[model samples]
Target: MSPGLQLLLHDASGEWSSAQYTFDQIAGLLMRRTTSKAQDETVAVAGLLGVDVARLLNETGQDARMRAFLLQVETVPAAMVLANAPARLSFPGFRWAPRSFGGIEEEFVRSAGVATCTADGLITRRELTILSFPKVFVSNSETSSPDRIYLHLPESGSLYAMPDLRKLGGEGVHEIDAVIIFPSAPETPLVARQPVVVVSTVNAAPGQDAEEPLECVYRFRAYLGNWSDRFRPSQMYPEMFDRPPGEVFITAQRWSRRVMIT
Candidate 1:
């Protein structure tokens, strides 16, 4: 028998009397259910095993035995899933406003060299406008609130974004690059690194035809930070400015919310 299963069986035998009733109930359910195959069978196995494991791990005077048993069970998928699944990233809270040009819209307009007439004064024209989408915010924990910034690339028909960093200055200023961390597995607990370039600051403008015209193009570079590590490449999306004709010209709105990361 495999070392892992041997350990499980040994532990089960040691706790047989206490765990028999629960294991019998779970085994009965599995035998009676014929409709579900893989899923139901897996659940039944986990249920039967989990009861014994929990009793041994939680009962008094079973510390050393339980610890050894748990060490062996750590390699099991069912045990790992039940143990650490709660800490994984789930339902990340943050909305992306690609169309409305949220928060960064004003910066995008200024970067695009679009002049806006205001009551106080007229804004000067800029060389390029770049906008990042899906501004992330801290939704759950107060202690750790990481922000993710997404950049929209019109020319490539894609969007590039990252968490934990943002551009420092406007167009024609200092060039910026970002390093992102990727995890291999939920249980591995190691972070892999990748580098992404912050392209130029050009923004797309509303065109005369149905599709929005390409206002300007920006250039950026992406390099994986750690050579030995592997990570999934960032995703890209088609040009979002494609709109039907006759759409009214509206000034882009700016996102005002600020995120602070220590």
Candidate 2:
């Protein structure tokens, strides 16, 4: 054998310590390196996944491509999702998902919780059990609040939306769906009550119709505050803007049917 190959084999064997790193971790590292050098991400992903590159490239449907990529992801600790800034998913259906864990932003959520990728991973449907409110009036005021933010939502009935945030498109009150998420278990007292609230609004991408079947779906936004009679800034919870959309969703129910991808 050549000297270079011989040296490589020797060094590889010497570094085969499971305590330091498992085979999967090493393989993942190599895959990232290879992907960085490769011109096409799809080709690189397919090669590492042992799938037919030609078939994957030629696949016309976006859903097929998304399914092929998600099927090969490692499911142990719930395949890595929600990459930090500068690293984001660029694929068709996965644009909302992150690419890798970049430094400190990796603490967005505990786990992705076995994502159920469907409709080519573009339209992921996860069951969430949260405190759902029919409507909320979001407004930015210069009043006495800590953050100068005010909000009002009913407990049993729906109310008119007070759209004061300029980013929401219009100036009038529009009805929108809102829900509160508990990052920790229900037993935690510091944040035992609702700390993180998210609202689901219409997909407001410019030049794109709201009813189109194409990419760019609904936006899930996180806010830090509390509500007894009104909304006020909370000191208990951390900043939740960096949390992944998939991680924010939590459910105790299990799927009745199993999907085995072979």
Candidate 3:
């Protein structure tokens, strides 16, 4: 865990009394079951106290004194919501926003002979499997534009690696264990088959004058490997492409935009 989160957990453990008090303050924000009405008053009290009622109740491992304090805190209208309906007091559908590519335009292009390679099939299957796992955007940084992106892939499942073919390398012979295809443009194939190490350079869109400055563009490469693997495709080829978005980040944004329009 990061040092900041570790400190947070440590501080939470150290001040059991204060933490419990905070928890109770959160619980008080819930509505009373008997009245079947919202408890704006409790929420106001919690806000005035500058306590996060939701986080307090979610805290675990507090002492009996803390728990007792929670009971008193629950008397508040906001806290009543927890007393009446604990589940409702739980925060749901809360999530971090996906990082926007902004001026960057992503296009996938399939390489000419990637489909003919034997490893291509395995790579494609692995890509599909990785897509099934949850993804998270860890960080993004760049100058002309965000050139690097980090992602956390889930480790619940495993991925088998293809045999190394670098020793037998030849012109046009498969040098990478995996290949990623991109969406093709009008004259380009929908997929751009890229080796695990190949970095993509984002070129200006066709027909705009060279003198006209282009927006910041970043190209990223996605690699396939076991979740625990230390070498990420993006890290291996930083000079080439940026990084792929996490599966969850991509999915949430896609869903959110769809929902908003609908």
lDDT of each prediction vs. the true structure? 0.25, 0.32, 0.23
Runs of candidate 1 exceeding 4 Å displacement: 1-122, 132-146, 152-262
Q: Tens digits of per-residue lDDT for model 2 on 53-166?
A: 665566544444444545455232222232222333445444434333222133333322344444344331222223333333433322311221223333322112122233
**lDDT of residue 102 for candidate 1:** 14
**TM-score for candidate 1:** 0.18
- When 1 and 2 are scored with TM-score, the better candidate is 2
> Candidate 1 residues 7-106, lDDT tens each?
2233634653323333223333433234332222222243335424443434333223323232323222111111111111111110000111111111
Q: How many clashing pairs per prediction, in order?
A: 12, 3, 28
Listed in order, each prediction's TM-score against the native is: 0.18, 0.39, 0.15
In angstroms, give how far residue 135 of model 3 lies from its true place: 11
lDDT of 3 by residue, 1-262 (tens): 1112211123644643322244323333322322222232232334334434454344442222233223333322210110111111111110000011111132112222111111111011111101221222222322111122222332322222211222212122221111222223335422222222211112323233534322211112333233325444443332432434321111100000000000
User: What would you estimate as the lDDT of candidate 2?
Assistant: 0.32
Best by TM-score: 2
Please give the TM-score that candidate 2 achieves against the real structure.
Answer: 0.39
